[model samples]
Structure formats: structure tokens, C-alpha cells
Target: MGNAIHDNDSQMLYLKKRLNMFLEVLESVDPESTNLDDIDRMIEMVDDLEVKVHQFKKSE
Candidate 1:
């Protein structure tokens, strides 16, 4: 129904917003910290977020 469509749209927007936020954090990474294991983890997390977002869209 119309309500389900509206809910999905809202959730999609929220997910996109979170993606942008993650991208921003990635962009702000300090070059000096790039050598650390945590940096690798952060990059992986962003990749995972992107994959999950794509999967969510496909599911919808």
C-alpha cells in the first residue's frame, strides 16, 4: 500500500544519509594513521556498509 511505500522511501533516505556520513569520515582520515590496523578496519567497515546498503535496495 501507500504506507509501505512511504516507509521504504524514508528508510532508504536514512540509509543513504548514513552512507554519506561514513564517506565523510573516510575522507577525513589522517594520512599518518593510515598505516594502522584500525584504519584498515574502518575501510572495511565502509565497504561493508556499502554492500549492505546495496543489498537492502535489492531486497526492497
Candidate 2:
């Protein structure tokens, strides 16, 4: 049980890091100056991270 909890916590931390990185990237980009493809890719990455986080929570 302890190991499971630890694993969950680690996964949560990783997810948070990914989210922060995405946010930084998004913030660094100027909406008017950035291309649509880059914005789409960032959005997709965030979506994927969210799905992973949800899966981790469900497993716990």
C-alpha cells in the first residue's frame, strides 16, 4: 500500500511538471505571432497529460 501511494505521488508530480512546462511554453508564445500548429500541439500535449493524470487517480 505504501509503494502504491508512493507511485501515485510520483506520477502526480510528473504530471504537474508536464503541465507547468506546457503553461510556460504557452505563455512564452505570443498569440498573434504564433502559428496555429504550435498552439494545437501544445493543446494536444496538455490533453494527453490530463488523461494520464486521470488514469493515475483512477488506479489509486
Candidate 3:
């Protein structure tokens, strides 16, 4: 039980870090020069995050 809790905590930390990275990238983006590829990359990041979230939940 303790190990499971620790694993969950680690997963949460990883998720938090990933989210922060996404936010940092978003904040650094310049709207005036933003292109389709940038938008696609951001969408991909969100999708990856969503997948990790689901995986974390399933593990619990």
C-alpha cells in the first residue's frame, strides 16, 4: 500500500512538471508569428498530457 501511494505521488509530480512545461511553452509563444505547426504541437502536448492523466487514473 505504501509503495502504491509513493508511485501515485511520483506520477502526480511528473504530471505537474509536464503541465508546467506546457504552460511555459504557451506563455513564450508570440501570437503575431504563431503558425499552424505551433498550434499542432500545442495540441499534441495536450493530448499527451491527457493520455498520461488517464493512465495515472487507471493505475489507481
Top-TM-score structure, candidate number: 3
Error of 2 at 57 (Å): 1.6
lDDT of each: 0.71, 0.79, 0.89
Model 1 Cα shift for residue 49 (angstroms): 1.5
lDDT of each residue in 1-60, candidate 3, tens digit only:
133423787999888988999999999999999999999999999999999898889888
The top-ranked prediction according to lDDT is: 3
Superposition TM-score, candidate 2 onto the true structure: 0.76
Tens digit of lDDT per residue, candidate 2, span 1-60?
Answer: 134433766887777888898888978988788998997998898889878777787878
CA-only RMSD, every prediction: 5.5, 4.8, 4.8
Span of 10 residues, lowest total lDDT, candidate 1:
1-10
lDDT agreement of model 3 with the native: 0.89
Ranking by TM-score: 3, 2, 1
The positional error of residue 18 in candidate 3, measured at the CA in angstroms, is 0.3
Q: In model 3, which runs have C-alpha deviations exceeding 4 angstroms?
A: 1-6
Clashing pairs in 3: none
Worst 10 residues of 3 by lDDT: 1-10
Q: What is the lDDT of residue 23 in candidate 1?
A: 75
